[model samples]
Target: MKQCLHFLHTALFARAEELLAKRIIDGDPLAYFLQGQLYFEEGWYDEALAQFEKIKEMDFQALYQLGVMYYDGLGTKEDPEKGVEYMKIIINSNSPKARHLKYAAAYNLGRSYFEGCGVKHSDKEAERLWIIAADHGNPKASVKAQSTLGMFYSTSNPKDLKKAFFWHSEACGNGSLESQGILGVMYLYGQGIRQNTKAALECLKEAAERGNIYAQGHLVEYYYKRKFYTKAAAFARRIAENDNIDMLAKITDCLPVYIAKGVAMATFYLARCLQLGVGIQQDQAAAKNYYSRVSVSLQVHSVLLLVLPIDWINKFVSICRR
Candidate 1:
């Protein structure tokens, strides 16, 4: 016990010295980025911005990170204008890294226009920009554009189900978890597609395997609905065990897409596991935390149900009616 305590003390003090040395490290762009990250985490936005700005030659990733900070109010005040300014500079550059940033820039600019954030609202213009981004292979933008196209064609004078399917397919093929999850929903609901439980499960499984947390959360239900109780319980264990924050962010960021439709399924699976203590160590507190998130989602969904369009209601009703 004394040896263990001594080792812990030495480890702690060594870490402190290492941190101090890191703070004094100079002439390193990566170090500046690291410092900027530390400052941002501490809410010292101005100091973080200064560190980021001291880089002698900004790489594409640095430019992208700076844009994100500007947009997210991380190391600077939220400024879509400045964010897009940096984005445009990289977008016009010939660097290979700039290609992805170019698509991201177009997507952000389109969103700004669509939401009238320091710009005018123009659906046509928004679609144009989204198409440009999608064409350039931005997975996020492709998902957005495809989903938008699906919605547009879903309710129009001359509904083009094929067009909707094409866009959704494109987005799904490009590895957009959002698109994969949505395509699963469309298949489950027979929206511009046949209702195939097997196909829907396949889509969800693919997305889930790709670290789409939302899909992982939703897959719990699809497995359950098929009476694959063991599979459902195992899936919950996998998600709870996953340590990757980026994958978690995929689920956390677009949580509504899954929570709105998958909460009941997740709750059911979670309850089954907690009651049986299957695979995971039984923890009521953990189960309650997940339930609480589902509850909040329920409340938001209830509010959204009030404003849902008639056509959307009809479509859902049609699925239920089947």
Candidate 2:
């Protein structure tokens, strides 16, 4: 029975439901809980509430879930006060059964305090509860707590950037995608730790591979600036093919003479790739258009020099020919 219940909670729902049906027919209380969870997942909140209500002696898990339903108005009218009361009861209880329920309850109650849902808005109180919940062995709550702490320390006034770095790094390690991207940027600029270009590239690349768009953009710029034209073109092509015209325009615009020479080289390489179908599809018309624009700009510069002294024009012509 315990193993079946564990399976249900651990998300082997189909198998758990099949096994739980027989136990529920036998009027097992744990089976009621499992059935209630399945019903809740299926959005049959009324049926779930009926099943949960059948457990006359509610354990912490049942009580916590009931509180959640009330607070969210899932199967009943919204009653924040009632939800808060139920959560408080679980927090104050020393019951050995379903002890893990405290982490979820505490996390939810902390959010209520944070948002002034049912309780008065109190950041300190919310932080306290989050700390407790985070320490209670819940991975979700722990990630939330670490992410919140990272943001809290990331302020600029009395900069606790080192602590911010630590929290974000820890959160990233714990699978927080936002933290991974933020930490990558931080490493790039040496916000708290020493700037390590290699480490920053590695971190941003990892995040980009995991579908972080911001990291992808940064990688495009990084490779372009470093004269890694092939890599820059690849990343830029991804953004362009995804229909991000603004970003593609930004990549192309980097070729202006006033910008770094490496940027121009990268842009030219990208245009060539698009033109020749090197790594991406051939777009000869688009390539010709870009090349024409570059030529027009250089011609404009040459025409401007035509107004200069005859000696300067001769020298400029000589330089252009060379």
Candidate 3:
């Protein structure tokens, strides 16, 4: 059973998958869960949905999986209302089987509220639900909630920089890659803490090497502002050149939207350098082309949320004002 569970996550093991499927034929509940997981991971959403729906009443994990699939419209039409109800079932369950899943469910529920999915948009309720999930912050699964709380506090109107710093600090310590990169940003800018260039550089450099796009974005800005035009342009060009919408969609599907801000930032800086010919070879036509992509966004549930943070608006405004 353990091997089969591991195989569900490792696509290289076809034999183990066959074994798990065989077990499913015998009505093994655990096999069903593992099978659903395998299908979900492989992007076989419709099959995964069918498997999960069958055992959702008995398996907390299946219920949670169903909630996520329905909410996200994975292999099915969007049904945020049904998704929320499934999550609520897991949250309200008194069964010990639900103990390990409640925190994650709460976090997802908080995101639903925060994003106004199947629920009224309520920062107050979102904050409340997230706090519950964040309290279980020691677990790997809990780290996402911790990191999201930081993002929420940092960007929401009437922002709480202090709390944002605290939550980000907590999430970073809990091993959230996103939070680790954001820590660099906050330290560099003194968002809610004392400015520490040395600490900021260390954090950003380490996170950037680990592929934290947020850190990479800020690193580009850091280089550009310091007149390290060559290094800045080089870094930004790498990200800008790989502008595949499908790839970005896959990334944003799993990561927070703000990560797109990093792509936007990198692209914007690269475009600026090209326009000014301050770094590398300047190409006016190339500069204009890149500028056009900085404000791009992705559509979700009929709303075009700026996954790209198309934050170029802020940058363009800064440029205009100058």
Q: What is the per-residue lDDT of model 1 for residues 62-158, given as tens digits with 9 covering 90 to 100?
A: 6666776787677567887777677667767887857766666776767766777646787677767777777734455545665555545554457
Candidate 3 per-residue lDDT, tens place, 122-154, comes to: 888999999888984665557889989998898
Instruction: Please tell me which predicted candidate would have the highest TM-score against the true structure.
Output: 3
Q: Relative to the unseen true structure, what is the C-alpha lDDT of residue 74 in candidate 2, on a scale of 0 to 100? A: 91
TM agreement with the true structure for every prediction: 0.59, 0.60, 0.83
By the TM-score metric, which is better: model 1 or model 2?
A: 2
Tens digits of per-residue lDDT for model 2 on 59-109? 566778888998999999998877887888877778877466677677778
Window of ten residues with lowest summed lDDT in model 1: 255-264
Least lDDT summed over 10 consecutive residues: which range in candidate 2?
254-263
Cα lDDT, all candidates = 0.63, 0.65, 0.81
Quote model 2's TM-score. 0.60
For model 1 the local lDDT of residue 292 reads: 55
